[model samples]
Target: MSENTINAVTRRHWVLIACMLSMFMAAIEVTIVATAMPTIITELGGFSQFGWVFSIYLLTQAVTVPIYGRLADMWGRKRVFFIGAGLFLLGSILCGFASSMGWLILFRAFQGLGAGAIMPLTSTIIADVYPPKERAGVQGWLSSVWGVAAIVGPLTGAWLVQHFNWALVFWVNVPIGIISMLLLVRFFPESREKTDRRINFTGSCWLMLTVTALLTALLQAESLGYWTLVLSAVALLAGWGLLRHERYSGEPLFPLAIWRTRTLLAGNVGNLLIGAAMMGISAFLPTWIQGVSGGTPLQAGSALAMMSIGWPLASTLSGRLMQHTSYRFTAQLGSLLLIAGTAMLLILHRESPVWYAGLSAFVIGTGMGMTSTTFLIAVQNTAQFEIRGICTASVMFSRMLGSALGTALMGAVLNYNLMLRLPQYSDPVQQVMSPAGREQLKPANLDLMLTEIAHSLHWVFVVSLIIAFGSLLMSRLVPVQKPH
Candidate 1:
């Protein structure tokens, strides 16, 4: 292992570049799809099924994180990542040829499944390559990939759709993925000792079922009121079965005992609430801007873009912060910033300027970067090398779950208010998003609905503020970091 670690070809920077490119490909999937979906619908004409394309991808990705994380630990990060990247690239290629929205959604799900490995392993590999002091800074740069992807994704998609074919957008990741995989094969030579390969396949299946049902229920709460309840029941049963099995299984996939430690407990819980807060703001703040603040879509995007700015900037700085201060202090500071940022959001109104929204977004993003980075490093430091992959995956899994939870809960909040305030109208949120749709409504109706949207958005902010405070309190429970 030391021999490979010292090999000249696999310099830290090169591997970092590969990891960044790999993650950027995965991270950019949603935004690029957002840009290209119009063209896709025009050509393929599955406007009714459009949302499923994105949802299925994320659903598959989120469910597979724990699975891949466990595999990475058992086999090796390199091996698991190779399999995932191959699947993702294959999905990308197949998606290009998809003739219908159903086919595209299936292919995107494949891409998402691969992405589960790509995203979490980036950090796990970084932890393998870098020590504690350097880890935070390097991970900071890694965190910036999402920001870069967000900025770059739309432009790239638009250009592809304009000058080339919309189908080509799906193909773009192939070369990037190939290059990333090649770098790893060349640089990351892992001499992993074979371990017992009899994994708890049953537990894995049950876990997947549990997560899928729960996420589906949350995503469809407003739309599929009855089906959502059914899904929730299934999820609860699946979760119970998983727990029961894990207790008796010889090698549980979940590693439940580890969660008893304060370090992972506090860190994961904090990460979860932070995820909720971030999603609430990301999902709705733009709604406030476009529908309520009377801003253009471009202006609204720029407002949310402030988070992209704050995220990378704060992420890059968090390493140095950990170097000087304790992990607890750094994460605690981030938690405070989170509360402050969400509080700032409470002040936004129809009369509030776009920059004010941008400022709030920036503050929130800054807090997320700081808190997430510190906790990630701290968790990695605390975990045994053998379990490090799962530990890293746990951070991402918590965030992803938190995101799903937050989106559903806050969307419920927004929809409940809309239903009460605009009783005669159906799907006011949709009309709020579309200028043409807004024009179809009566002027008086439009004004009243817009006012209601702004009011409900404030309630969303209030929910986010509460979650942010929870994140802070959770951060307080993290144990002092011990160097591995």
Candidate 2:
């Protein structure tokens, strides 16, 4: 490997620092808000609208990632990065001033529009700056930023809530974001030949509408009941229109080349499946640990922590493996490990020790690290520099879509199973799944309810295991050798 490809130049290292800061800022937002959610709701006095704060951010972020990415390719990464950072900072400042939940949600949506650009561009810039082999390790560094944020965000939010106003949580991002923007503007040089492509405004609108419809329907499925079906239909039709428009448009929002790349297609499918499984683990594992095994909340958290540790370690190692082996083999190893870890969960019981869960979590995390890193590096390598941003954004979008779909499906399964098991007390059974709900039930019925919930969780794990194996199958279809 050439020195320029294998090692970062001083300039590249500085760029990576800026990327890391931008990444950390976005990563922290994902979790930090959760810690202050209750306090915000209490202060804002819109209990019914509280969930919108998170939903709006995720929805806008997911919808706009590709748009920002394509614009980055057309305009330039530096300009795109600056715009994203500025918007994110402005939204954060506005959020600090929010007097009600409605205002907070609106500000969050604005923040998410900025985040859409920040995430994909972070990887795209790294790809531009680093070679394929080196990209894996650098990607690991970025992956670790999320892990670190997961650990620190809640604590930081808690500290801010206790010591200062909750607004400080949003205000904290302003300085970091500004610093990142300055570093990018000062240090990172734009080298790509900018594409003089016509902006696909119609395609962008249809794509956004489709995603909004689908995400909103999925999120509001329980509340909206039959109306969800109508929204889903609208989403399907809008998505079809978007695809048709992209197929004929001179400058498409979603490039047709994405559909033609075999490896990219397979890798994205695997990402979607893995993202779904990961969400299942995140959403339901705590309930299983505390309710089924009688473990403390701290113990449940430790299991997740183990997964975090395992992910970055395996991610860093995957980069080294790419130097010796093909991307396909490394990613396949990750898929196999994921299946193994999830398979372990099938055997878990009320009597299974906490270490068993922790070990399983760690192994699965390792698989995710390897698989995600391999896909990102491989896909970016396959695309030309001009379209790299969009390709990278596609992968991220797939993961987010997977998480939303997976959570919804798994939730349905959990609810259905719980309902079947306790047909008589339908209302109380679902509520009892929560810790506070468990406490509300009579002592004599607690074990019975826990057992029923445990059984339902078993089905959830079964769904995750199936998804992991599907990911493995998709990984097999990925091209073993990197494309020239």
Candidate 3:
């Protein structure tokens, strides 16, 4: 009730708001930009190069996350956050001015590097500021931002493109990022004397190289073909070198202690599998609705929207549930839901209703929401402040890697099945995406296309179900957290 206490409370709220805003900007950035890309590509006139704008951004973000995590812990969250947010906002400004696809790709890379810092630090800073009892509830608010962004971002992007210029999609981040940065600068202050500032340049380079090569191989596997093998080899070499260097370094960039913590490791494993399942559903569900079930794009999208609905609702409940129960129990419940959801997916076919697909998506998303929050809270609770940033970033990195792996794995299965049944078509999925496209084909070709796609996707669903079971195993392996 005292004035200083009231001032402190206000400052914390402002800081939380800033974190939320920063998170929203990052979360919405992909969806909004994607919605506007068709218009931007038409204007920029490099349809071939536009994919790099997204791939480069993802590669940079994933690679930098662990590096930024270590840096944040060593330098301080506020300092690192400012650097990241500044880079992101600057990238946004530059993207708005970009006249060509190449320039946009380069600017988006800058944005990705900044995003690498912002994502993990938001949770880390919230952990730093709030007490244990209050942290989960506040984290719930952060979780909801993702759902809100998912629901709002594309719609906003469509409106912006319809009425105004496509550049507004990039510019929109400017005001939001500026407000977030100013709020943090005012409310969240840091001191150089409080941080270690120990730079591990060699280890950092090795880490970055490893992540870059690995992700490059994963992302470019299809396009690069045999060349991906060389990248994969380089990634393995870099990874081995990194482990050796970190073993003897006085201050390791990636703390070795993390591997020794069973609960933390299990939590991250759960996150990884959850990420795989998430990618499977999000990537394929809409395609299933459109290609397999003969639904429109909007109908496909509406089915997918069920995920955003389930996610926010479950996230709001997860913190309270975790507060009242053990993390193991909550995570296990989520895993079971994942199993149920993925099982539901197995029953879907060309004749299945869209609402049924939507229901399945909702259940899967609810599972993801519950497990993700539980894993994050448990990881943070287990780690001390000196290592919290790295711990949090590890979670993010795990999920990213898992998602990439999932995309590759499911794509392989789908492609394998498609090729086995229908060998002549190089782009069967695309051929089946629209009714008009299918109508142009012979009846024999259309029947084969639909049948193979449905069969291939069934295997993809089977893989997701396996991943759900793996998550359950990880959940059971998670040692119950003693309350903080």
Candidate 4:
């Protein structure tokens, strides 16, 4: 290779680093708020609308990911990425100044729209720059950022909220975003592939509607009984129509050919389920700690820090193992770990030792590290070079969808179980809950509620276990030979 070739490759590597850093900012922000949410909601005075703050962000992100991914392919990754980063920064600023819970939720949706673009495009850009054999190692580095961020995000968020204010959590993104944008503008090469293709506006609308309806049904399943059925039917119809449109359209959002491959379909389904489990645990576990363990915000945050420890370690280790073993075996081991970790949670109680809770979290994080990185590699290996971007984006889309559904569904489940079990308590118990409504329930009542919450959470883990087992089953479908 010439000197210019070497220089180009080196620059590309640095670009990947910069992109990954920006992605880490986004990922961390999502979880950092978890520990700080109690403080945020209390200050903002809207505990009733608390779930929407998270849900709308996820819903918008889920709806926009594929659209952004497709646009990146058509327009260019770097340009679309900058647009996303800018929007995310703007949303962050607005969120920092949000006066009410409703405003915060709405701003969060804006943040999600921007965040949706960053994740898929980050991976797509990596795929564009690296070959199959080297991609796993690069992905391992990216995955490590997620693990590191998870640990840092909550702890940092707690400290900020404790000493400063909840607004600092959103404001922190400002400098990170600015630095990432500057790096990309200076160091990253600007590349675009010009295509005469037009946007599939109709198909995009249908796809968005389908996703919205599906998520709405899942989120409201416990509340609006008849609306759930109506929304579900709408989702099914829209899904069917979208499929038909894509099959006939000359340029589809996602090519039907990708789904025809059994490996892609099975791997994506498993990814979706894993995403649900991961998000569910991440969102609720802190609440569980506060409820059951008599923990302060920082203490609850510390418990989740264990997951950050395990995830990156396993991700780096899995990258090395990929060089020696089949991706199938590595992914299977990860899936099994997920099942074991989640199953352990089924037996968890308020009296369970902190170390035990941490152990379960570590196991779950290890499983996430293994499965997430490996699945991305599998999708890249299965698809052709030209379509690699789309395939990779599709996997991410599945995970985002799963996460959205999981957060909403788990929130509803937790609420429902609390309601069901609350009636069993005596009048004194009811009086304890009356001050802050459910949020102000006494520690004893809180513990009682959390026991039921744990039961509800067990169902989540059981679903996750089934999903991980399913992923293990689908690992066989991945072709032994890597695609060219």
1-484 per-residue lDDT for model 4 (tens digits): 2212322555776677787778888889878887789998888898878878877887888888888877776777778889988898899999999999989999999998898888888877776676667677778787788877877887798899999989999989988888887877777655455568777998999999999899877765656688888999999999999989998999898867567887778668768877788865676666556555545556666777778778877887777667678677788788888888888877877677767777888899898888777777878767754465567778998987787677666666555655576657543223332335556667676656656656665666566666667667766666554323
lDDT for 162 (candidate 1)? 97
CA lDDT, every model vs. true structure: 0.85, 0.84, 0.85, 0.76
Runs in model 2 lying further than 4 Å from the true structure: 1-10, 427-444, 482-484
Model 1 error, position 17 (Å) = 1.4
User: Model 3, 357-459: lDDT tens per residue?
Assistant: 9999999989988888888888887787678889999998899988988888888888888889889987888988966788899988788788889988999
Candidate 1: C-alpha RMSD after superposition = 2.1
Q: What is the C-alpha lDDT profile of model 1 across 30-132, one tens digit per residue?
A: 8898999999999999788887898888899999998988888888888899998999999999999999988998999988888899988988888888776
Q: Note the residue pairs that clash in candidate 4.
A: none
Off by over 4 Å in 3: 1-10, 191-197
lDDT digits (tens) for residues 1-484 of candidate 2: 1224323445877788999999999999967898898888889989887778888899999999989888888877778878888888899999999988888989999998889989999988888788765777888888888778878998999899999999999999988888887887777776446345767899999999999999998877887899999999999999999988988888888777788887788767878898899977887887778767777877888887778778888888888887677788988999998989888888888799999998999999999888888887888888877788889999999999999899899989998998899776765444564667777778778777777778888999999999998887877766667423
* Candidate 4 regions with alpha-carbon error over 4 angstroms: 1-8, 35-44, 161-166, 220-226, 283-300, 346-351, 407-460, 481-484
Candidate 3 or 4, higher lDDT? 3
Error of 4 at 422 (Å): 8.4
